[model samples]
Target: MEKKLSFRNSSFLLLFFLCAAGNVGAQVNPADVRYLGKMEGYWTMKTKLGIYAEKWKRVDEHSWKGRTMRIEGNDSTKMDDMRLFLEGDAIYFSIVAVKDSVGEPVRYKLRVLKAVGFVAENLQGFYPQKIIYRWKDETHMDAHFEGKQGKTTREIILQYTRR
Candidate 1:
């Protein structure tokens, strides 16, 4: 009877310490986990038709998820679902558009060029060859997309304001 009680007490203490260690491990910050923290929030851009809004949220220590939509008149249409995550030393940005619902997501690699912003690129194709994100302020940013269309180079700039 005494041996049985000793065995049970040993097992219980082992389990308790294991659980406590796991809780402590969870508190450790992962590598570059908070790199995208500045981008988390509700943002909007005004267009001629109406408004385009984007929402970004931190899903975990290493990932941020975003959704974008366009509101025109009284109708709202989902634009895309975006995910940004840190892997190894690189940050990946993926987008799955509503129109291309069945295909693999378009992916870009983001490289921090300076303290103010990063540049993302997809070298596999010409449609969205490069994208530059620069912060005008804490509450405002400009995203510039550069691509090729037939024989011409095209660029589009999107101005975003935190809402």
Candidate 2:
């Protein structure tokens, strides 16, 4: 069974710590994963918890590597590693945390790829079974994570800008 990364009444901090695939006749065009290269840069957001930062880079046309960090004062903690890759005609999004599964990533398949952004889903995963990305402009983006915990549903959105 998948673990609940965040409880319904708990802070969303644990989510930044972890956080996607494809099929034929699928709305998702795996080729479009390349367009995400636009995300290649250092992005950050200031939150009550501290500074939440993410760095994305293109590994190739078919892959991109990203890392998330939580910064408090002079201390910065590595939260997770996010990866996007294409396999056959499908695209996948994965998050890996050092303490979880010995750094083995949990993946979500790309289910919605749009002009503004995309959506990946792993309905059977943790607190956030869905990862949605939407870009407001060249350097502004919103990431929405959603899932159900018991009888209640939870959603967390993080707005990020070029850092």
Which of the numbered candidates is closest to the native, going by highest lDDT? Answer: 2
Sequence-dependent TM-score of model 2 = 0.77
Kindly give the stretch of ten consecutive residues in candidate 1 with the minimal lDDT sum.
Answer: 1-10
Tell me model 1's lDDT, rounded to 2 decimals.
Answer: 0.65
Q: RMSD of each candidate?
A: 20.9, 7.8
Candidate maximizing TM-score: 2
Clashes of each: 0, 5
Q: Over 4 Å off in model 1, which ranges?
A: 1-33, 98-102
The ten-residue window of minimal lDDT in model 2 covers 13-22
Off by over 4 Å in 2: 1-26, 98-104
- What would the TM-scores of all predictions be? 0.71, 0.77
Looking at model 2, how many pairs of residues clash? 5
lDDT of each residue in 83-103, candidate 1, tens digit only: 888777667777765122346
